[model samples]
Structure formats: C-alpha cells, structure tokens
Target: MSGAIEFWFDFSSSYAYFAAKRIDALGARVGRPVLWRPFMLGTAFRETGARGLSTTPLKKDYARHDWARLARAGGFDFRLPEGHPLIALAATRAFYAIDEDSPAEAARFARAVFERYYIEGLDTTSARAMGDFAAGLGLDGDRIAAACESAAIKDKARVMSESAVARGVFGSPWFFVDDEPFWGHDRMAMMEDWIRTGGW
Candidate 1:
C-alpha cells in the first residue's frame, strides 16, 4: 500500500464501532496503518442534509432489527442503548484532545467508548463518562473532563468534522485509502479487495 487508510467515524455510530474493532488488523494485514479520524456527526448531518437511518420512518424500524442481525454476524455483543443517539460532542472533543498527543491511546479510548456505549449501554455522551474512560487508559481523568469543555478542544473537534465534510464525507464508518472512498461496514470486503488489487 502506498498510503494509510483514513477511517472516519463517529462515536455514536454502531457501524463505526464494528469497523473500529477490525480496521487495525485489516490495515496491518495489508501493510498499511489506519488513520483513525473521530468526528461529530451533528455538523456533518447539517452540512449534508442527511438523517440517521434509525430516524427515517420505515428505515428506522428496519434499522433497529438490522443492527442486531449485523451485530450477531459480526460477533459484536450489542444492546440497543436506552437513548439511541446521545450528543457526541463532549466525547468527540476528548478524542481529538487525546489524538493530538497520542494516536494509539486515542484509538484505544475510541474503542472503549464504543464498547461502553453499545455493549454496556452507558450514557457515554456525558463528560464524566468520557473522563471515566480516559482514566482507564491512564490519562488524567479530571484534566480530560475539563478539556472536553475547553474552547480549544471543542474547536479541534469542529475543524476535524468540518474538514471531513469538506472532503465529501457525510456518513459514519467512511474510509479513504489514498483518494479511494468506501462507506459502511458492509463495504469492508470491497475495501479489502481494493487494497489487494489496487482498485479496478
């Protein structure tokens, strides 16, 4: 591979959680590093006029059912969270703050957040939840909790999200291998094929 795979994801996206669990191994197998990009989806939705699949009438019903099926197939233990979509702003800001100094730790924190939200059904939208997760990673919980509300961290998260939107990303679990774009966990096979065959 000539370049790393840019994995753009939102913490509230279950599909992104599935991808996050596997992207690193997939990238390693193909001799490429996965660049984890965490972004807030609220701005992306506003920019693209896109709504969540689970919020769209008939699609919402199917999505709830499909989420469980996909989770089972992917071997990811999932429970429908009490609050389906929690505001991801604080958690996202925390991610960017950690990512700025340590990408690896950021990845770990991201996965932990996903697991906490989906499997454990915790309300990870809270700054306290974010701080708890960060503390587990040996980070300063109070500092990170404070950072989540800081102007600098907030702006960083916004810029990262807006930059993704500017790059034509309007969905969760979106990936770019160099200039090639792929979307959704369902497209993982295609992405792997593209990596191996260098695209058609």
Candidate 2:
C-alpha cells in the first residue's frame, strides 16, 4: 500500500499506447490508481547510457515485425508519427507550466500529446500542432506557449526521466507495483495476476 505503481511513459511509445488501454483496469483490481509519470525515453537513454532499439540492425528489423504482428492481433491502429526523434521538451513543460487550478486541463493536454503521436501522425514538436493540441485539450492557446517556455517544466521533465532510471527502468512503458518493476506492455498480465492474489 505504501508503494504506488508508477507508469513511466512517453508520447512516441507504441507499446505504451497498448498498456495505457489496459493498465487502468489492472490498477483498479488492486485498489490502486496508477500514477502517470510522463518521461522522455530518449532522455532516459541519454542519461542512463542506454541505446534505443535502433542500436542494432537486427533489433530494428525485429521491432518492425513485432509491431506489425502485435498491432494486427490487437486491432490497434498503426501510423508512424511525423517526428520519430522529436523534442517533446516544450510539450512536457506546458503541462507543468499551468497553475494548480488547471490540473485537469493540463492532464487533458498531456493525453492529447500521446494521442497525437501514437494514434495520429502529427508532429508533436511542431509549435502550430502543439497550439492546436492545447486548444483541443480545453486550455487557452496563449497560455500553452507560456507554459512551454517555463524553466520549471523543463527541470521537472528531467527529474522525472532521472527518476525512471533510478527505478530500474531502461525503456518505455515501465510499470511498477510496490518495488517490483514490470518492464514491457506484455508483462501487464503478470502484474494483473499479482494484483489479483494480493501480492502473489
């Protein structure tokens, strides 16, 4: 009970998208609400000295086939976002830049970012797209630009990424229950089982 499950994710994570659809139900079974911690997996890689799946030719090939198979099986839509190595720095900042009174709005904006990249082929790094995305999220577009420029938000993003590494997370879609880290969207069943048995 003392340790909450942290969901460390980024916008471009395809598997993260898959997990997001299912994690809430798993958390509900455990009487725990998953804390959504958005962090840049790219940042985590840079800091932790871990290379992305693009490091090896074989790995990249496998990823393509895996995603295709998984996407088809799950009936999930597949579209590559406009920006692969996107700088989500500003977007992350915008969420933290908003005032406490606007938390719900901020969350909506964050969710939009995810949907933009994972579900839609929008370039999230584009200012115009971000402005529109913010507007769609029930936030004032003017305020979105200001939030994107906040130093505090950038710092928070960095801290969140570091925390993900500290928690032994080396990639996207990391889930934790108590001190146990579950890496990958496929491991959700394991987490669900653990939750059902009350610490099995």
Show where candidate 2 strays beyond 4 Å.
1-4, 98-107
TM-score of each: 0.95, 0.84
The 10-residue segment of model 1 with minimum total lDDT is: 120-129
Q: List the residue pairs that clash in candidate 1.
A: none
Candidate topping TM-score:
1
**Local accuracy of candidate 2 as per-residue lDDT tens digits, 1-200:** 25567777776676777776667677777788667667778767776787666455787678767877787888877665554546666666665665334654655666667666766666666545666677776667676675565666567767877777877788878888877888899888888787677675
Q: 125, model 2: CA deviation in Å?
A: 1.9
Best by lDDT: 1
Question: 19-74, model 1: which lDDT tens digit per residue?
Answer: 88889889998889988888877778998788987678998888778888888887
Error of 1 at 114 (Å): 0.8
- Candidate 1 residue 194 Cα shift, in angstroms, is 0.8
